[model samples]
Target: MFKVYATTPESMGPCGIAAHAARAEAMGFDGLHVPDAIHDGLLLAALALQATRRLRVGTSVLVAFPRSPMTVAVAAWDLQQLSGGRFELGLGTQIKQNIEQRYSARWDSPVPQLREYVQSLRAIFDSFQHGTPLRFEGEHYRFTRLQPFFNPGPIAHPDIPLLCGAVGPAMTRMVGRIADGMITHPTNTPPEYLRTVCLPRLRDGLERAGRDPAALRLILGPLVATGVDEQAVAQQWEQQRRLLGFLYSTPAYWPSLELFGWQARGAELQALTREGRWQDLPAVVTDEMLSAFVPRGSYAEIAEVLRARYAGLADSITFPMPQDTAQDTQAAAAIARLRA
Candidate 1:
């Protein structure tokens, strides 16, 4: 069984995020994983950590390519200090178009680049904490400058955990080799895919690096349909269908589908996106596929379902906070069960 985290919804601004974090803490969630999509992840983390007393605040993934490692290190360091060691920084490399066009950041050689980014962050942390003289030279990034006046200097907690979002083998392997943890993409967390592809690849990297597999946190952020009753559960299942319809449209996420002989369905979803048939997309995901991916049960039983599904695989799992505040009590009860 794995501990549950509140997966903070995307597109929320500062106040909403703080409120959500406070609510999650009140509900007994061990942590909140905030997104870096529409807003600054670091800023959201600051608010989330400040608002909550005991809940861990982490960026589910803050895009790594757009921001300099030095900038991220400083922000993460400060958040760790302020949170009394409950801040985690999860990093990711966005696709080329978004990285280059949307963010206006140079994008090339992502796996290596991300590997270097993690290394660079660690080096910067070392310099900041112990004054070890920052010198991380890699193809994508190089940092050799750190004046004593500019350095933020040591904090009470210097061993900040660095997590990464990874789906592909290379990125997953890199995560095992370097990062403190790996957060699975929602589409890539099906048990068979993880057992066959992800865990093995991660172990390869861990073996190469001579790091213990137990040290790597494998968090499964799967889609689960939970509610007080069947009707409410159905609503969540439908929502997941629409979300998956949008997500699988990206070919980059097709490998998991390919493993399950659903690659053609992924292509079909992509075709619908290309044809701009957004409304029709959800219909493409059949009930069979939905059942295969999502766990659906009442809040009272969903924890057992998750345990049966993910035990011995994921070190932690994420369960979404209910969209309606009315459902908070049931959702909170479910989280408590998961934690226990």
Candidate 2:
């Protein structure tokens, strides 16, 4: 069965996260994927976990560079313990400009930095689990001390499944080499992009690491524009198109555009952003480009469309909760079919 996870919108209020998670569980979703956008992702995850008994909570992902590995490990450990081993830690390295400017965090070579981050987190978790010495020295990060006094010793769930977000080749390969699983960024979640670009690099990494092909999990969070009917789908399409226009403007996410010979369109979007033309961004996203990022249909058939599109491609996928609670059953039906 392909697991289906619930995702929240960027505009959702913090107080709504718990209610959303409860609804997702009631709707039969396997898990909830929270974002580190307007609200702290872990805090939101805590809310969700507290509100639901069985639904797993994970960060779609949490930004890694801005916080220390040990700090993050401690939080993740506690969340895992609290969730009864239901928490998955998914980390992502935001692009340089966002890291340096928006986050006021140091930005270096991200592939290696994130690799070291994941390794250091495991080393810390190991020490916390078994009374062993904590020593992980990497080019980007070094952790040689974990005094027993400071160490939050062992939880029942010692193995917190470490997931990484990846879209580029270097990052995807690194994730396959180190991550227990990977969360595909929305911009890079199309079926063709996964088959032609991501899977090959991932296999190369898995081969390099001498790991079993099936051991690593791949979760595709593709942008989907589906609703109860044609009118609803069209509304969702427009919303997703505007979102894609904003996302593809980032050069790091342009690999998908390049794959489809739409790099020029990507550049045009970027130029619009550079000129501070925020309102014009949506206009630049044509139907053709929108179709690449978002698969459109009614909820009645969207699951079949996705199943056929990603049949053997992904182990898990993300489905967002509808803004209106009235349409949840319609969305839930699709989620159930995907999970089946």
Candidate 3:
């Protein structure tokens, strides 16, 4: 069965998390996914978990640099226990500025750092399950004596499915090797790029690790904006286009867009930033740009587009909530069409 999920908008504040999760469950969505941004994804996940019974909750990604692996592992374990084992841990290495300036952490050798992070998480879980002493010495993390007092004890499934948020080849491959699934960025990657570039790298990683690629779950979060009014839909599309333009302009996000035949536009977007043309972003962003970056239409039309876009690859589809619509009614209508 294809699973549908929802995200609370970045501007919606944390109070919307429980409200959205409740609507998602009541509307028959399979899961609730929260993006890891300046906001707290785990806190949102906890709220969602408490609000719904059957809906699985997870972060689209929690950046690796902001918090230590041991700390994340403990929190994840506690969430799993509290949520009755319905929590999935999604992790990523965010760009340099967010890591260094915002989080006050060093950003170096992300691939290696991520590998060590995953290893440490697994090691901590293993120690809890088997009552064995845990010892791991990695470039990014080291743990020698894991006190029993800090341990949350074993979950029903001690091995929580780890999902990596990946866009490039190295991270894609790493996901197949170590993660149970992957969460892809919608604005940066097209479906064709995912099939031709990202998926192949993932398969290669699974092959190298002696794992079956077919067994892995692929989760996609397609940025979507739906409204009952056509004019409102157009305005929402423009807003999303400007937002994506701002993101693609960043050097850290350019690689993903470049992979999908948008290098020149990516460079232009970046140039706009260099010139401090922030106000002119909407002018540079065309209707074509908005359509390519996000699915936008009336609720029914958007649902159909999403169903088609995610037809085969996505085991779960997460749509970022429409900026112009009422969350509860829009969610109910979209879920009705998606499940139909």
Q: Which candidate number would show the highest lDDT if scored against the true structure?
A: 1
Q: Write the per-residue lDDT of candidate 3 for residues 185-286, one digit (tens) a residue.
A: 765446666667777888998999999877688887766767777877777777677788787777666665665556787778778888998876666666
lDDT of 2 by residue, 272-321 (tens): 99999988988888898888788888989999988888899988989878
* Candidate 1 clash pair list: none
Residue 119, candidate 1: Cα error in Å is 0.3
lDDT of 2: 0.90
Clashes of 2: 0
Q: Which pairs clash (backbone N, Cα, C closer than 3 Å) in model 3?
A: none
Q: What TM-score goes with each of the models?
A: 0.98, 0.98, 0.92
lDDT of 3 at 319: 63
User: Could you tell which candidate, 1 or 3, scores higher by TM-score?
Assistant: 1
Q: Between candidates 2 and 3, which one is better according to TM-score?
A: 2
Q: How many residue pairs clash in each candidate?
A: 0, 0, 0
Better of 1 and 3 by lDDT: 1
